[model samples]
Target chain A: MTHGISMAGYMFVNPGEEILVPSLFWGNYNLSFINAYDAKIKPYNLFKGEGLDVAAMGAELMSEGDKKILLLNFPNNPTGYSPDVREMKEIISAVEQAAKAGKKIVVICDDAYFGLVFEEGIEAQSPFAWLANLHENVLAVKVDGPTKEDYVWGFRVGFMTYGIKGGTEALYTALENKTAGAIRGSISNTSNLSQSLLLEAFDSPTYQEEKKEKFNILKSRYEAVKQAMKNPDYAEFFKAKPYNSGYFMCIELKDGLDADVVRRLLIEKYSIGTISLNNLLRIAFSAVAVKDILALFDGIYSACKELTV
Target chain B: MTHGISMAGYMFVNPGEEILVPSLFWGNYNLSFINAYDAKIKPYNLFKGEGLDVAAMGAELMSEGDKKILLLNFPNNPTGYSPDVREMKEIISAVEQAAKAGKKIVVICDDAYFGLVFEEGIEAQSPFAWLANLHENVLAVKVDGPTKEDYVWGFRVGFMTYGIKGGTEALYTALENKTAGAIRGSISNTSNLSQSLLLEAFDSPTYQEEKKEKFNILKSRYEAVKQAMKNPDYAEFFKAKPYNSGYFMCIELKDGLDADVVRRLLIEKYSIGTISLNNLLRIAFSAVAVKDILALFDGIYSACKELTV
Candidate 1:
């Protein structure tokens, strides 16, 4: 996934160019875009009342220079929020508005957690599917693979696919060659053994069924977490950020509670693991079995209470 | 191997810095250093009397700025030349001379074709071993792995090792962390499955013996090529460059014989494959069996004649 992003960074942005990233984002984005490309990051508000801030994204897009690289990751890392159907439409509309205003845009759809959405209302398809052909000026570059979808974490196999409204075969071929050139200039190529294994796995008779089974396991965990978060006792500690998909969801800690302190307490005292990003406590429910979901939240609540005392 | 070089390029050289390369060199060096890091290539004469021009190398290092990046490839690509013990000493002396003159040098030992030496006189150990602890001013970085040694091309597994004079564990750890940071900023990590498999292969009882068997096969092919080159009839067409190891060897076409023309003729009339780099025709003896080496050389000779006609 990072290889694809690195290539995209090389392909699109020049040094010192601005890339619009969410204020709350995957930590590696800093390394991929800012560190590698020397591009400046312009952070925009990610959420408006527990949903994607589509209007803020559009406003940020317009406020920036005419040439913009807008990176969207969903189901997003750290937050684990995928846009619902209505939110997806709003996102497309926002990007479309920018394109209509004659802004040249490269929308990077980091669909690392593609097909992992648990809820029915959520948009199943990536923003790549919608914005790829929505506007002539917007180029949708989707970076995704089975690394997460197939639960093959360390395979290091991902793909960079380009799409644009009215995109010709020649255009895509050129983009592909350039991407290949970028790759050639760096690591040469990805592991062929990993690629062949993924190919073989795709051809297996139980591939779809197996993926469905794994998704169901994650979905049950998501359901359990959702149920557990409804406990009124936990509300005084942190408010669970609106989440319905992917591996994790964040708890926006109540004012005056340091997430890191709570996280350390949870680790040392309660033996629970969680990532603390400022006040947002990210819990990767995917790692924990469904049976452990309630205990996990209860542990966090206890940690918070202990910290307060 | 390319990944390690890419990391080295990032670590050592700043944009527009000059990297000293051999006049005859691997093509990918341009992509790795120049394209990726925006560094400049300063090519020094590679050969004097069919042996490495150690004097020219030393002179170039002395002539350059105080900081220099000296890249060396042994059992080198296309030329298949490895410095013998005497030549290796001269090379070391040259580097030591530069280091003594207050030059800060980063010697990149690209030992991609390590352990493939078919001759007795050649220096079996890499220059990395010699120059690494030679001087405090010199830093030796060795990029190598089972990719070539074990012939696992598609596995995409390689290692980057660092050595320096009076090096401490802390310094090495710092360098490693920086390299790891660079990797994290790009591909994230290598394929774990490929790594696990290579680990398993290394533990096998016949690992050393199997490697020896493969070496013997290549050595036999190398011997055949050497024998075939002794044919007096081929002397008029081209001069065989001094070569003893690696997959390939280059033949410098005699004046008026275009390498591309001879290559085409070989492909069309004789049904043989060879790479043309200006006047040098590279043949991969590693791919050709011992039984076919004579025919391969004869076919090249025949193709040269046809081109001349």
Candidate 2:
């Protein structure tokens, strides 16, 4: 599943070719693409004024060299921000614009934590649903897995689906063969037990009910975090990114304060661990219980107050 | 496990460098090393007069330009031959000799079948036990796992242990970090289920006894195949390679007869199947029952004669 994003970088993108990921991305993309394949990464601005920066992305897409690769992870990893239906449309249009400009775009949609939405009116579906089998110059590759969405974290089961148009049967077959061969060239095979367990679970009578129950539990935790953040006490510490989906949400440190000091102080003094990146602290709400959400935030707030002093 | 060989190629061996593998090798080594990494494969003849060609290997090790990687798999994949103690010593000496000649040789001992020795005189210990930390220039990397020896084929669990010399604590730590980083860059992680299952199995009451029982079953099958191959009725068809270990044994087609013809005829007419490679038919004794071994070979002999006519 991790290899889906990795294959796009290692197998599809040529060395030294620039892959335009967003400014805010899952850090492993760099390790997968740049460190693995020696490809360069160019970031498109993710957000402006608490909304997706579609215009900046469009400009970047049109301006970056043709025959480029774009990594689009919605309900994104760190920020947990999912684009609304209109935003999703605009994002696709940007890629289509590039394709219309005769630019070949291989869009890798990494839906790691798909369908974990906590808000209304924000469409939470795979870009695959629309982008696949849609265009000529745009090859939509959706990378997903049962690992997260299925709540089988230890299974490591993932999938890659290609929605490429403007190619004949032979061409498609060749492309699929290449994808399989790329997988073979990397990991020999996915573990069989995982695949079997997943298949059996899918066949089980309670699959949907179980999934919904799990989703509801996570939804409660997500809501708890949101309710706690509105307390006005954390406002002095950091402002969060516009987030309502996936496992995590990020808080941008206030007054340009660095997250490193705050992160270290929280771990050292308060024993509250969060992912520190740039000027933000990424809190994963998935594991935090509904009741513990506030206390977790309180510790972070205490750490910030101490660090600021 | 597959990437263990590849890591030696992609990480340890520089681009355009040469890797020395036996003429008879698990073919994926070529795919992983030469094709994937742009490294050249230098094959040393596996046999000289029905025994390991130590003289030829030593000569090649001496002549090949200083920086090289040697991939040693035993009990070998196709031939199932585990080198006797003397042969093992000769193999190590060749590397030590190269190191003494101011050459840096990274020996990747792919000990996939580490303990499955069929012959009495063959002490099939990993080369790491002897070669690791012994030389200044020779680095021994042993790759093995519970996948084969522990009777877990579907589980792709593997381990890679490095033994390098001329390194201080910091240097070694940095080297280990780089190796881990390489693994992280490739596959994000091996399946957590596999790791957990293996850990549980190790902690089980009868891990060693279970492994021993599995080993004994393979040993019986291996012996049966060996005894069956001794039938002079098959001599006209092919000459068996000196095999004493592992799952498979290969027979060289007499008079350079094409193995493809025999393989196809055996499948179509005799309803028997075998892996046809180069001029040899590789029979996997691991899966073939003790009583079925004779019939399997008889069918092959009948096919060979009919095809030859």
Candidate 3:
């Protein structure tokens, strides 16, 4: 997925050009966009009132350059949130408004967490589908893989698909050749053994059923996290961010309580690990046992209390 | 191997700077140094007569530039030639002389075909061992992998090693961090499954013996190719270049014969495939069976006759 995103930067943006990502995003975006391509990272607010800030996205799109790169990842890392159907439509509408205003937009949908949604009423499909054929001026590039989807973190297999309204075979062929050139110049090629395994796994008779079983296991853990966050005592320490569909959820620490202080306390006192990001504590519920979810929260609650004193 | 080379380009060479390569080097050097890093490729004559041109290399090193990147590939591609120990020392002496002349050098030893030396009196070990720690002003970088070494091409596993005189752990660590940063910005990490498999293969009791068996098979093919090239009939068509190691050998077309025309004729009439580069045809004798080696060369001879008529 990172390879794909970095290629987008190579293919589209020149040095010092801006790529707009969310304010809270995977930190590796800095390495890919800035370090790899020498492009600038322009961040926009990700959320407004527990939903995607479509207004902020639209504003960034129309604010400056003739060519804009809007990178969207969902359910995003650190703060797992996937937009519901209405929000998806609104996001697309905002992009459409920008495209109609003569902005040449490249919408990169990083669907690393594809099909991991655990909640109903959320649009589980990738937004690439809707934005693909929306406008001639807009190009939708999807970077997805079985790394997260199939639990093969080390396989390092990922893909990039390009979409544009009225895109011809010649255009896609040219784009593919350029992408191949970029890859050929770097790693030579990806792991063929890993790719063959994925192909065989996809063709298995029980593949879909097995995947569903695993998804249900993670969904149960997500439910356990949701159930534990309802505790009244924990509310004073931190407020849970809007989350539904991925492995992680963030909690915004209240009263300026140091998240690193709480994180260290949890690690030292309770042997629990959580990533502290400024005022946000990202808890990867996927790694914890479903039965231990409540105890994990209790540990965090105690750590926050200790920091308060 | 490419990743390491690209990283060396990224870390050491700046844009518009020059990277010295052999005139008959691998074509992908263009992609890695020129396309990826925007560095210039300055080619030096690889051969004088049948052996390596150490004088040409020395001349390039003492050229106008203060900092020079010298990339050397042993058991080199296209013309599979590795230097004997005496010639290697001469090459090193040339570099050391240039370094003493205040030329800061980064010598990249691309040892992709390491351990494949077929002839006696040849230096089988990588030149990196000698180049490393030779001088404080020279940094030796070695890029090699199991792709060719262990015959696991699809696994895509390679490594990069750095060495310098009086280098401390802190300096190595800093270089490692920068390399890791470059990888993180791109593919994130190599395939863990492939790496684990390579580890197991390395640990297996039959590993060395099995590898010896495979090496003997390829060596037999190389011997068969050498024996078949002794046929006087082939001299009318092409003269084989000096090759004693690696999977490939090149034939320089004789009497102004078009290599592509002969290649097409061989493919059309005899169904034999070979890569034609200008007046040279590269044949991978490693892929041909020992029993069929003579026939393959005969096919080429016949095609050349047809082309002449």
Model 3 chain B, TM? Answer: 0.98
Q: Spell out the clash pairs found in candidate 1.
A: none
lDDT of 1 by residue, A227-306 (tens): 99889999898998878889999999999999998888899989999999998999999999988999999899888888
lDDT of 3 by residue, B1-309 (tens): 777777778788888999999878888898888988789999998888888899999999999979999999998887888898888999999999999999999999998889998999999988789988899999999999898888888898889999998889999999999999988988888889999999999999999999999899989999999999999988887888888899899999887689988888888889899989889999989899999999999999888887787
Question: lDDT by residue for model 1 over B22-77, one digit each (tens)?
Answer: 88888988888888778999998889997888888989899948999999999898
DockQ of 1: 0.81
- Give one digit per residue, the lDDT tens place, for model 3 in A192-286: 99999999999999999988988888999999999999999888888898999888999999976988888888899999999998899999999
**Arranged by lDDT, best first:** 1, 3, 2
DockQ, every prediction? 0.81, 0.61, 0.80
**CAPRI grade, predicted model 3:** high
- In model 1, which regions exceed 4 Å deviation? none
List candidate 2 segments past 4 Å from native: none
Candidate chain B TM-scores, in order: 0.98, 0.96, 0.98
Best by DockQ: 1
Which prediction has the highest lDDT against the true structure? 1
Cα lDDT of model 2 by residue, A104-161, tens digit? 8888898999989889889788887777766788888889988789899878677887
